[model samples]
Target: MTLTEKTAYLKGLMEGLNTDDKVIAAIADILSDMAAEIAEIKDDVDELSEVVDVIDEDLGEVEKDIYEIDDDDDHCCCCDDDDDEDYDDYDDDEDEYEEIFDDEDLYEVTCPTCGDTICLNAAMIEDGSINCPNCNELLEFDLDDIEDEDESESEE
Candidate 1:
């Protein structure tokens, strides 16, 4: 069942109790748990909506013709590309960028520190380091940072 429906069901259960105060408090506690699950589901949906999939190969069709904010970058998943190309993979002379990484979504990130633009799928950023071709500057977080972030999030 959908998270919203489940939350509503829990709310109804909490509302229907004509029993002792203890039972009512127990139902309230369960409702809180259900509400937290619903919030997580909402977050999952919001994150998934940011995913840019050009083709649903399983469905044999492309529903949303994915386009980029600029012509110079396409969020391609392949990370084995030459490190020295300096955005030959892009369309034209483009300078600015930001990380559009979703966990399963492809992201095209430009390194402000080294002036190197990178096309990272979920896999490359999973490690989180795209070294610059010229100065070899390590731009953005490495895998360690990613793990740290996960740990902090779990603690929350």
Candidate 2:
């Protein structure tokens, strides 16, 4: 049974006893007061629960607006485009990127001080040395030694 109903039942039982004891009368009054307070608290809790549900719905709408969430599909607004022409344009951009960078030779160099790897082209290496981007330490390259090693390897 509900707390209020249980309290009411107790009050009825106390009244039926017809006791002359002051303690029993006081206890019954206390139970009645407790029942009233519990009812008010239950009402307040229900109202707050409804307010929370409304706030949750509002927050959902705000999130949809901020993130461009579509209800129709799982994809974001940008990826929802059905046009093949837009996809073709993206492919053209990728081809242009490949054409520009495919011909150049890229070398990976590791910094001794910071242990960070950096990519460099031939023109950058021709400068003989570059400051390590991570540690600002001067890193020198001896192209003459590398050429001699290459020559020896060819002779072998």
Candidate 3:
């Protein structure tokens, strides 16, 4: 039986005993008080359990809202697997740029911090540096390094 039913049974048994001993009556009174306290504690625990269930349901709704927000976003990397398609578009743009400008006359440098590919002329690589558009980090290219490599290759 449930704890409440068991406590009720004990109370009934104590009442039926009709004991004359004062000690027995005092003990019965203490038992009654303990049973009542236990019932109150049970009620409190039930209320707390209901509150926990409601909080858990609210958390689930928040998770659904977060998912919906992600679903509505088209360019979010976490929401879709079309990152390769984005890269393909970048490649197409690069091809079109190459058709308009001679690739040999341009130097391509990728920003180390932001991975932004920047096209620079040979003169710019020698004396100029660019700040990355995406991350605003300074990017410097050393054209002397290329000249050094070429000289070493010619000596060999």
Candidate 4:
């Protein structure tokens, strides 16, 4: 039974016994006070829960607005033009690209979208792409090009 029901049952039992002891009556009074306090606490908890839900909803709206602003701001192609120049420089020095595998034999890749660092083995990279853990963005990598370069270097 609920706490209130249980308290009522206890009160009934105490009264039914017809106890003349002062302690028994005092115990009944204490149980009634406890039951009242419990009810008030429950109400307070419900109000707090409602407030939390409102805050969560507001946070979701804020995130949506931020993403919308980002989308609108993406129309400026100046950032992409800078990235193109960087890529061209990287392509010109292809021979300078060393193996990214660290001591644990895992390739450390930075997600292009979220910039989160991720570690993956050869097979995982060979799958062509993986989702970024931080932003769930699809991060593509070229395993075929790396393998081809390695094969040519070994033959030389």
Candidate 5:
């Protein structure tokens, strides 16, 4: 029925032939056919090996997407703020704004209250305040008025 089955059948028949020239010739023909079939199988195996290698490479990239995180916070915002530590976005306006140390690699933000140091991003700091998600203390303070004064009033 299949190539493998046919090859096996021909091999058995070739071994059991009697002492006749016709039987010998038939055996030779079947051996040649079997050799060609074996070659085709080897080629198919090589192709499958290449396909498996590509699938393995794709799986490695998928692992990175699953493990990567946006924030690398260890203890989180609800922790204590270091009074002596300065924020990443510090200004020289006041003692509260002064940086505790010079660490450029790490981000820093000052808690509006107690002048505590908070290490985080400006975007995460949110609304001019370092509201410590760790201590539940509003670390940063924001005084915002989105309404702008009319230009016509200034001209008058």
Candidate 6:
């Protein structure tokens, strides 16, 4: 039986006892009040559960829209490689990007503090120094030595 029904039955039993004990009557009244409060709390919880389910469904739809999720597709949007044509297009774009940077000399420098390799260009090297992005340590380049070597090489 439901808690409310059980409490009501107990209350009816207590009333039928016709007891002179004030304590028994008071306990019965407390039990009845507790049952009512519990029923109200259960109803609130049920309503909240329904609201949460609706929100969850809404969130799932939003995620599908944002991520371009397809019901039949198993792969994630970013990592999907099912289309060979699209993959070839991506490769062409990458090759174009490489061609753009081919004329410019790229230098790789390893940070002494963090051991992270950083790629730089001639202009950045001419600036003499840059902070290591990983550790924020000041790294100075000896441009004079590099210039002297280049000059010597040209002379040779």
Best by lDDT: 6
Where in model 6 is the C-alpha error above 4 Å? Answer: 76-81, 84-120, 124-156
Off by over 4 Å in 1: 1-103, 113-116, 133-140
| Count of clashes, each model | 1, 0, 0, 0, 13, 0
Off by over 4 Å in 3: 1-17, 67-80, 83-156
Q: List the residue pairs that clash in candidate 2.
A: none
TM-score result, candidate 4: 0.42
Query: Lowest summed-lDDT stretch of 10 residues in model 6?
Result: 76-85
Q: Rate the local accuracy (lDDT) of all candidates.
A: 0.63, 0.87, 0.77, 0.80, 0.61, 0.88
**The 10-residue segment with the lowest total lDDT in model 4:** 95-104
TM, every model: 0.24, 0.44, 0.39, 0.42, 0.31, 0.52
User: lDDT per residue, candidate 6, 37-134, as tens digits?
Assistant: 99999999999999999999999999989988878766656654665566788889999878756789999999988899999888788889999999
User: Model 2 lDDT vs. the true structure?
Assistant: 0.87
By TM-score rank, best first, the candidates go: 6, 2, 4, 3, 5, 1
Q: Once superposed on the true structure, which residue ranges of model 2 sit more than 4 Å away at CA?
A: 71-156
The order of the candidates by lDDT, greatest first, is: 6, 2, 4, 3, 1, 5
Instruction: Give one digit per residue, the lDDT tens place, for model 3 in 1-156.
Output: 765576667767867988667786676677767877888999999999999999999998899788654555566567557656747888889988777576558767888998889877766666757788789998876668788999999999
Please report the TM-score between candidate 1 and the true structure. 0.24
Best by TM-score: 6
Whole-model lDDT for model 5 versus the true structure? 0.61
TM-score of 5: 0.31
Reference-based TM-score, model 2: 0.44
